[model samples]
Target: MTWVVLTGRQNHLDQAATPHKVITNRDYLAHPALFRGQRPKVINLSNSYAYQSRGYYASLLASSRGHRVIPTVETMIDLSERKLYEHALPELELALNKCRKDLGGSFPAKAHVFFGIGPSKAWDRFAKLLFDWFRAPALEVSILDSGEWASIRKIGFCPLGRMSEEDKKRFLDAMDVYTAREWRDSKARTPARYTFATLVDPHEELPPSEIASLRHWARIAEKMGVEVEPITKKDLARLANYDALFIRETTTISNHTYRFARRAQQEGMPVIDDPLSMIRCTNKVYLNELMTANKVPVPPTVMIAGPADFELAAETLGFPLVLKIPDSSFSRGVKKCSTFAELKTLASEWMEESDLLIAQKFIPTDYDWRIGVLGGQPLFAIHYLMAKKHWQIVHHKASGKPDQGGIKTFTLKETPPHVVETAVKAARCIGDGLYGVDLKETKDGIFVIEVNDNPNLDHGCEDTGEKDEVWVRLTQWFLDRLERQGR
Candidate 1:
């Protein structure tokens, strides 16, 4: 289902144009079926800055359900809060100081600053809020809040809105030019097929097989009438132009990849590594809690805050424990502490980054069963062997050298039913996105090590026997999801 919410004054302005469900901020939360079923696309048209406004919750609800909502309630909230203005403050201060220097480092009584969302009514609203402050004669500040400044980072000053040029030329011309460039780029770029932009780190060259997997996807997309293009950090502003996003790069909270996922999701596009999925799969602490709560079998795990939690960890988990920083990839930050001294020393260092850490029992397995799951079903399975003489698939040593492992893929029908069942169960604890659930075949039973959001899909490894099928199924899922959204 699709929804277009306009401001109270502009209700039904374009209802005759599109068949999408039209709503106001008042009706967004009141409707029961608003967020359910056919992946509704809600375009909230209310000012998100007002703390209790309906537009604010509209973005939040839409995002929580993984729907495409605009003005990104998240982005709006970030803009309004001072914390999100970290970058903007510096620029604003520089401009203000420069202006004040001409005025003897002080402002006259009539000096008033204007911050806006757009060039019109929002500017008026923001101007009213600053009336209590001293205003200087012939000094008015204006900022605009239009769709042009779309990024949460670049748009740090976004929630303030935009001012009209008639208010007087200010220091925001550079920002406006930046937004103009983005606008033109988005408008000029058009996709002939169902566009699927894959986000990748362009600088880091991927393996041949991994690159081939993309070719496999490109081939499948061609047959399915979809276009697949590789995108990096530079193409983030144009994410909204695509129909779907298939990310093939490692994801982190502090990187542009996560922003791409967020942008795709907010634009109502079907994106893998959806922001929520990234959050859930990235952190081991969250995964451990989620798996245990759902009754999925995970290795005995403990959450350590500091040295105080170490003695109980030693008693409950015993020696030779596996230490993990909350979020890590490629087996980095994961250590095997065979002794208490090592655990203390390592925990101290890791704790500097995060207060909490994950300590799981050392379940020795020659190889870990990596089950590729998508849309809550098993797509493919692989036996990921540990690096030679190492306890994990990836061994990053103190010298910064790394040793990698081997992977043997198995067709869906060739895999064990138990492994598939266990993997699906574990991955479900996170979400129905594409995931790699790592499992161990131990003496007692199959224990889930952890779930990876971006599992290795190296061309010859995970896609070996079922290469075509894997790529085809992955691409088909997008078509199916798009169809569902339209329903």
Candidate 2:
């Protein structure tokens, strides 16, 4: 069987003389096989018609599978003046020759022939020729309505259509997976280790126990597969090479640790035991405000803005209250007022020494809950017991003997559940990854008494038989996170 291709315009034939095979838009959509593998040839039958019918012919043939051909009709006018005659002629000829050779003989009379033809202007002949040279091939052509040529050119099919939607989506998904894997590998290739420069007061050398603890931490770091270097104040410049820092001694923002931490933060290193944390932790008033705002239960407290605020505070809070300076820690600069007269007298003394003080209702709690939080998670909890006959955990007796008021410790299991919950909640509210929370279980509920940014890890304290395991776990967690993030 022979196949024929058509282009340009469709012509009416005598149905009695030749059996006709019609390939219409409805026929193609219903039965695509009717047009597939067929060739089409187009002939211009109308004069003075614009090139509008090309779109219909293109759409029909593109939906089918075959070559397309268009016969050139030249006019005496200039090449630019003839439209369809100028454009599509060359490509149509090429398609016609191919289709004829492929079909093997005379054009198939019953074969599909699609054509889109319209009148052309003499001035547009050259431009039309250029477009015709690149016209896509189709199985059949048809004479479409006027103005259809422009629409066809706009929405016509290209030989270089993109892959199917499913294939494209699969390709993109694979690319994403590959990119993620590469990123993970790159991060794993470079591990991040921190260098620590801790200040040791040369005048006040570190105690033997403290030094031992430092060594212990170093060993823990090593076992956890992390690199750590400990340097002194004289070697402070070495901090520039580290990821984070820790200050061993009590220091102020004006001191060396603050400068180091600030510089590290500027260098894009995540600094813990940060200066701002230190400042906030050092100030009792700031802690109280933060705890209260976060809805963490706290003892009823009043600020002694000045000596005058003391009388009103005393009347509201009543006697047997706690008074403390804004920035004092370690139970220092704190006093308990048992009576109104005593409160007034202490307020006056404190007003002379400090600009602000806090008076809180004393809950008469015997033990305080201490919790160490890292990365917004509670690592451990302990109960610090007060000494006999002393209301505070720390005592400043002139005798200098081991103050009976020294603190004793207990494990999380021994600590009350409400205490742990409150401490954890308070620590999370603070939002700092590392901090210590002191909570007191009151008659009403557990109240956060204070938060310490840089909590102490004193040696020889009650181990609760899990110190080694806890430290190892914490160190490993930090190291794993650092490694995953590539510092």
Q: Write the per-residue lDDT of candidate 1 for residues 93-113, one digit (tens) a residue.
A: 344344443444443322333
Off by over 4 Å in 1: 1-192, 205-209
Error of 1 at 81 (Å): 23
User: How does candidate 2 fare on TM-score?
Assistant: 0.55
TM-score of predicted structure 1: 0.63
Candidate 2 per-residue C-alpha lDDT over 1-487 given as tens digits, one digit per residue, 9 for 90 to 100 = 1122221223322223122232322333355455443332222122221243443433434323332222222111212233534455445444433343333433322211111111212212322233333222212222221221211121122110232454334423422321121011222222223433344454533221265566566566655444444555544423433444556665457576666667656644555566778777778888899888988898898989886887878787887899988877567688899988888888888889778899998878787777877777666776667767788776667675434344566667776777767787777766555677988876788778898776666545533435766557556655554456454
Q: Local distance difference test, per candidate?
A: 0.66, 0.52
Highest lDDT: which candidate?
Answer: 1
Best by TM-score: 1
